[model samples]
Target chain A: MTNRNNAVNNAQKSWLYRPENHKKLWWGFGLILAATVVVQLFVSVHGHFGFDGWFGFSAAFGFLSCALMVVFAKLLGYLLKRPDNYYDDDA
Target chain B: MLELIFPPAFILILGAFLIGPIRAPLRPLIVLGAPLLTLYTIWQMGDGIQLTAQFLNYEIQLIESSPLRRLFATIFAIMAFVGGLFAFRQAKWWELAAAQAYAAGAIGVSFAGDLITMFLFWELMAIFSTVVVWCGGTEGARKAGIRYAIMHLVGGVLLKIGIEGVMVHTGSIEIQPIPLTNIDGWLILIGVLINAAAPPLSAWLADAYPESSPSGSVFLSAFTTKTAVLALILLFPGQQILIWIGLYMIFYGIIYALLENDMRRILAYSIVNQVGFMVCGIGIGTEMAINGASAHAFAHIIYKALLLMSAGSVLYMTGRRKCSELGGLYHSMPLTALCGIIGALAISAFPFTSGFISKSMISQSAADQHLMMVWLLLLAASAGVFLHAGIKFPWFVFFQKDSGLRPKDPPWNMRAAMVLLAAACILLGIFPEWLYRLLPYPVDYVPYTASHLVTQLQLLLFSGLAFFALLPLMRRTLTISLDFDWVYRRLILSLMNRLICLLSCLNTALRNASNRVFSIIWTYIGRHHGPEGMLARTWPTGSVVTWVVVLLTVFLLFSIY
Candidate 1:
């Protein structure tokens, strides 16, 4: 049981520490943001501005919203977290 | 020549019972043969043939022969066939039997010509799907299955109410497009939306789907939501509200997939995202958009199955589902990785894949309608799909940092299933004419235009780039993020706790009040009837006589007065 816990901890920490994987992940995010900006610019230059502007705003806003949700989840977990088997049959 | 017997889901129902009586050696053959026979029957009933029968004063339509219905049913049958093949080895008899029954329900739903028959099949699907989840034989799976059943049963009840309302108000249960203005229509819409994984109830899907056995998830992914899509197209084509809801689901899926650490859960969330595209198409409600929804449903099932098969294989081989724990598997599981990548590409709607051919029609429809914002957001979502599912899935599972795990490819049956689906995904993308001919609409649209291909390539590839760029934001953590299920699973739990606490307090107060009343009664009785009291035992007889005389005298005096 201790070994299992340790393994899980190591895996969780590794997701954060790994550099090459992190680089690839961030690169993907960067490219999407860049593309969205480019597409918005193209649309605006072509005088198709309102829809494109809203689309770009929504994309950025959606990302922000998702990030906010993660933070909110973490905060809520602190209040709610209990023993893993708090409500299990044995407990 | 014997006339073609078109029993829509008869094979599955027969298979379910037959499996119990038959020898185990022949069970797989029977199970696989059932769905194949269903497909054959569906094929035999060519376009424009409608077969109806009556049951319990309700009109039951066995076959509603249209290109769309045929296409959905065909895929369902195919799903059963492949899912059976995949589950042949280790899935218990009960699970296989339940799966066949569930497949029959899907086929029944697809080919139903009336709402009543659809509802019957719908509930059956619910029951059998729960059985499939329960067959996982784990506590988590059992709990998840129950929750899943509750959601679907609720949805089913709502649907039945709607169907009855439509029957009463409209005086027709013929399965066709109905206006969304009236109460009955809205009920039907809500019922269908619930199944489609619309908000506030959508979490039941991701919650329940991943808990099923790995093989079961593959089957679970294909049928229920897509059948709802088919129903939506038939019933509520072009309802504009579906656009926003679908858009919500699209992003909801991507963000959840990003945060999800469980591999199957990520795919589960991605199912909602993929269905979102179909729902959005239905909302757009043009001939082209409806076609897109139908075609995409057809293609999504195949590719999604392929993806799940790959994921299931990984889980089967290594018994690992978390991305954080899995990495550098491409060395040992090369075929699985390749199949997974193909599924990912197909799902991402990359150029020259199944997704490219099907998803583009919906986007094109949105563009045509000049729903410019809808178009652009959808385009961004297209990119997001590639970033999240396309790159994230394979990257984490097959090519991440080595965890020193050396699991081999899955069993041959599993690999065969994956290969078959992968081949179909490519075939549909490359030679879409066969699929096109099977659409409800006449084929006039071209999927291989340079501009269309270029734009899609640009959007998806760029999104892939963004996924890499935003690596910091996309790290997998060992936690579950909140979804619509929180409304019931968390919020309701807290509410129940509060309610229980309040009830206990009230019960204590009630108990005290009752105790006080009982003590007062007891004190009166002791004072009136104990020894040395007015009604003591020694003089009880005489005293009682005197008391009776006194009471009679008092009563007589009162009457005289």
Candidate 2:
């Protein structure tokens, strides 16, 4: 059933194609992420720093820091960004 | 009485030159065989100086053997073999040859017992790696290669100065733990750091790497920086400064990676980020940390190559590299996508990945030292790694809104290379003991402990959540974020232009002012002395008599005096 391109069957048949699957994927992914934090209650996680051992600390820290980094990178892009061809004439 | 007259470097170096002139069919054999042959030579020798040769006045170790170097050389050979396979069919003959020589240079550095030998091999990598960059054969590659060479040569000069200084001062060319009491030691560290793609000069990696050909990028990904890591482990262990430098490199890499749109460049910046961990580990300088750094270098080379191979495949098939221009590729390039995700996960240190095993040792070492702030920043870096490389690379390149482009996985050789490296990543992750055993120091730290696994998973998964939540901001743009290279590449050049302009204006004004003063003087003289002047006119008889009387009076005054 596979063509040389490998997607003759895959393109439309891919679960990622369906509108409803998007919601399903998000919900499932969100559940797994939440469970990682929830699993901490039972997993007896030890953090190197005492502050790190608090419930959901890594989750909160990971999310917040990443958010801040993304924002920061965006801010940096405003200053440093140039068209991909910015160096074309120079080169 | 035996001498390694050929030097172990000769095998691949010879192979590199032979690859050019040999019959077309036999060239591929040399391409693959040379590195393997060198690897065999490496394992054949045991620790300490295997062979020494007199160079001018000094006896230098032509080949030094240790468990540490043997490990590095082994991976380098493997990388060359797989890289050759991935590249041979697609790359220019010269490119393949140059890359072989480049690998030889890395191997030579690995076993170099003296700073002199290391410096020689170091420049060899510099020269041929530049050639490999030129192998991209694009206008961009041409320019970027120039920058890459200049940076490496600058680093090489620093290293050479340090080595010569040590030789003159201490009378020892032997590569040993150098003291930073003097400028020489710091020069050596700085020299090595520049090659490690440490900050202010880190842009060269991101700038030059992505410009190489798809296959060229694959080879480019492996050698230079990892060789620098090996050098650091050998020369500068326990230097506390590396920890801060390493930390700076990590975030700088991640931030630039996030702001990047080029597919290969994202991976390039992550190279700096991953090496940061190794550098930080070397700074920790405990047996565990050194072991971690050495092991991570091994693990990183494979996965980073895998990541690039996947990206290279996409580029090869679609002829597109910008993430903004690429999407929905997973639909067709399932295998590439899978391998890429595996590489991404491994890089992120997700459980059951090589990164998980190797990188944790560094963090554990930091924790053991009770380096609270350093340890915390490292944890955040871990999350950031997952955010930028783990999720962002694959999400944008493969799974973003469909670009409606469906290209198949690359040719069989490329595919085979990817699969093999992907397998290596997983196998090493599952059985890190094999890698751990090869470390320069013993590794007693366990990687799969339950608490460690739970926390790492939480960190990575939550980071994943952050990536999607900030998806709007993370969207690919057709732009590049500037770095320190901007100073040299744009600012300095522009300033030089302005300086020249200012200098030229001053030059013109000076010329005009001088000409004006000369003309004024000329006019005054002409007014008095020319044909129309009082002295030259027919009516000048009265003025001549007056001048004669004044001259007589002046002569009388002088005579009286």
Candidate 3:
């Protein structure tokens, strides 16, 4: 098992899989958020409705809707999901 | 030379036949060359019924050219070329042949000017696509292929019935935009909707598509639903019922896709979602809206195929398709990762992608019409698209907790095909004019305005944020979510099984009852007919004489009366 662990460590030495490189990925995400905010300040937004004109409306809406969607999907998954091989018996 | 002009669809159909006989190494040349030649032929012809033939009393318009038809046919040809290139090494020659034939049917439908011609090609598509699904060679593929075939064949029958009815009523077979007021039109709309993967029956797309082989899925992605969208644009534009149906389909796709586990099934559900945008655009039915639907179809074919190709590559390399079982593949397969992220971005309508240029037109039209509710929902769905397809696909497949599987990118041809499509997506997004010029309507919209860009970025980027923030909830599971196909695949099938059992039981009971009654009658008959019975025990001569005297007395009384 120790030898297998060593083998895995060696195989995972690629730049992306390195433990210390995770910070860089998080920083990239942070930069995207910062850029979105900066862009909002520069460009005029045209909103179709009253609520849409509020500052960060798109950001809030995008985040909230997606969050809700994920939650809903998780709930739905409980009801609908079956084992991956659910249809294998029929076949 | 003018008379010698043949329909481009025929070229593909002929190529389908030719592919089988060719030697293995030479097959790619034919597969790649045929679509290029067909594309050249498509460009050679000018507008208005280019080829016609007589069928009985009707003049069948086999090839029609308008910007709309040309746009669809062009994308289809491009798809065939790219799809064939991607699959040439991976797919069996027979699968390749069926794919070519399926593509021909789409091209044929695109050029078909009359309902008869369209129906003929429609069934042609149905038949060949089933074969493509069956090419997966899994038992699941066989069963799913049958279901797919049954669904599409039913759609085909409805379409044929509609066409016959319309012909009998209107006395013309010409393809024209008609309202859904009449039975004929409604039947046609339902038929087209089924192919579009609209509600209730929409489950067939997700049910069958993911069951196909990796390369086969790429081909399967392009042809059927897009052709159905073309049919709707032609036949049922501006119909109000479609607006509601389209909205239902969009959300249905998003939710179902969100719940999905298989990598390709997610993409399949999103196909319904993407086509929903096109369907809604057709519902809007403005020049801008129709153009949007057409352009979106063109853009969608490329990106969706690219996305499926990426998924196909993973499946090819690792032989695992469930998202729960895949991760950290980006480390080993950088090209596949890059191409897939590009596809996911394009699907989300990121700033400079094919989807941004095409899908926005529909929403803009909604805003232009002051459809506040529709615009808002479309906006929400745009973000939802990111949540389900855009982020869910790549994050889980490539970036989630490492499944510790290290598989390399696919072969050169597959990589080349993906790069080609990804490049097209960006090029079209940056230079929308190239695509705009080919649209049926004149170009007037700009996709890169400051406000549009900023708002789109916020919507997409924030959705990305949401995806990461909600990552815990989105953990992949070793399961599949049920869809409406369950009614037929499980519920209805079980119901039929039970009914058969009941029927057999009743049949046995009735047979037993009849046997008992017949035996009783036979026994009664036997009792009297036996030699030892009263009649056989020697009748008395005295009784016979008494009976004769009584008979004589009755006869005398009758004579007197």
Candidate 4:
């Protein structure tokens, strides 16, 4: 059974899972980041508010807000989450 | 010449009736053909009240035309076509019939020239949509459909009351723009807000939508809330309360969706979130804001439908809906994966997507109005959209830990429907003018500035980064998050149960008390009249005759006096 499972896994492995492909994906992502940063040199961003004009502000804000959201959601889940069957009786 | 001044909605309604009696193999022709004819009629309509008739003391306008009304009608017609195509073979024939009738209601609402006319179609929508929900054919679906019906019926009653009050107060029934200042106005606003899935009552969308069958959800997503948005744009534009209300809905949707495990429920929550942007725009109430709101609704219906279609396809193929049970589908179902990603990108408002062109207008309007706080919060919500829906949806369902489910793409019709919507998303993003021209107001906004593109990319990509980084925190459990539905689903029901118990107890006590009182009275009477009593004794006849003679004598004496 183990050998059969291994064979299935190997056969299903697409190009996304190759060992060397990981480095290429990272480099591609890095290139995108560099491009966004470099574009800031030529174009003046018209900030809608005070902090939005700062260099890489969107990146920082998006990252921080999302992290905070996840943490807050985790905390909320502690209070609100129940077994999936919580409403089974009523349903 | 078309002599019959037929309402565009009637075509689909007519089709709905005809579909049931028609034989199979040719049924798809009617389903597909009706909406196109309706679209033709909608476009043929010019900007004015087309058909009006007298009903009792008031004039009822059945067809009114304006750019806003036409825009909404166009989308409704398009949705009917796409949804019918998606459900052609998968859904029961009656479900499709009900769905067409439901679409007709939405279209009717869009062109309704008076409150009475709009109300007529509004209830039609409520009834038929419940049928669609019932078509899910599960115990849960039946229950959810009942709840959905009750909620909408209450909303419909509120609306009817408001309409009557307004007509009596103002002596007019014209469907013109109005503010929520009086009791009638406030009632109308509440009624519309219920349909918009505004807070406290917002749980119905999440609670009921996922209970639908795979194709049923695709039809469910399109009409009801967008029509509410249309009504809000028409009637309550610039109402300041809507800003705060829309903000609450946005965050509520994000938080709840973040904690959700069911794939479609997450999409449902995000519907509330997407509608929030439009609601906020309506609150701003500037021409640009109204344009933004309407255009967003137009863009929203397409992409939201696309997202739900992808999720529905997954549910259809795997017979599983929980994200915990789905993954590694990208290996076998590349088309579904790609389409799902496109939908996710459009929803996130990533650069050069439908969301970017339309949603930015609302935030831009906020900034243009110098509402600094609103602008910032909208900006954050934009990123949060990516966090919750854009990443969380596709990542878990298609790319997360392999659950060994190898479901393939759905049937050709479903795939064609999804691809068509996906193409619309990209096309709208690439060319905003096509949609902008359809807006009720003229457009001066541009969406593809270099700075705008960079910032949006930075925001979306970093949010994506945050998603991967915080992956451990978002781990799906076999759990559901409680929402405001608890009040109705649990608290209200339990309260009713307790009240019934108390009432029955009171009823039993009252019955016992009444029985005791009657028995006591009967016993007293029995004692007085029993055989051993003085009146019932053997000497009673002689005494009764003597008493009668004595009473007669007394009566004669009194009469003589």
Q: What tier of docking accuracy does candidate 1 attain?
A: incorrect
Give one digit per residue, the lDDT tens place, for model 3 in B427-494. 99899999999999997899998888877888888888888877888777788888888898789989
Give the alpha carbon lDDT tens digit for every residue of B226-261 in model 1: 999999999989989999999999978877777777
Docking class of 3: medium
lDDT of 2 by residue, B289-403 (tens): 9999999999999999999999999999999999999988998999999999999999999899899999999999999999999998999999999988998999999998788
Candidate 2 vs 3: which has more DockQ:
3
Give a tens-digit lDDT track for model 2, residues A1-91. 4574556545565688656688999999989988888888788878787988888888898998898889999999999899887877794
- Summarize candidate 4's per-residue lDDT along B490-548 as a digit string, tens digits: 89999999999999999999999999999999788778787766566677588989999
The DockQ values of the predictions, listed in order, are: 0.10, 0.67, 0.72, 0.69
Worst 10 residues of 2 chain B by lDDT: B1-10
After superposing the true interface residues, what Cα RMSD does each candidate give? 6.5, 1.0, 1.2, 1.1
What are the per-model C-alpha RMSD values against the true structure? Answer: 6.7, 4.5, 3.8, 5.3
Off by over 4 Å in 2: A1-13, B1-7, B538-561
How many times do residue backbones clash in model 1?
21
The CAPRI quality class of candidate 4 comes to medium
Runs in model 1 with CA error above 4 Å? Answer: A1-91, B517-561
Q: Higher-DockQ candidate among 1 and 3?
A: 3
Displacement of residue B146 (Cα, Å) in model 2 is: 0.9
TM-score of predicted model 1? Answer: 0.84
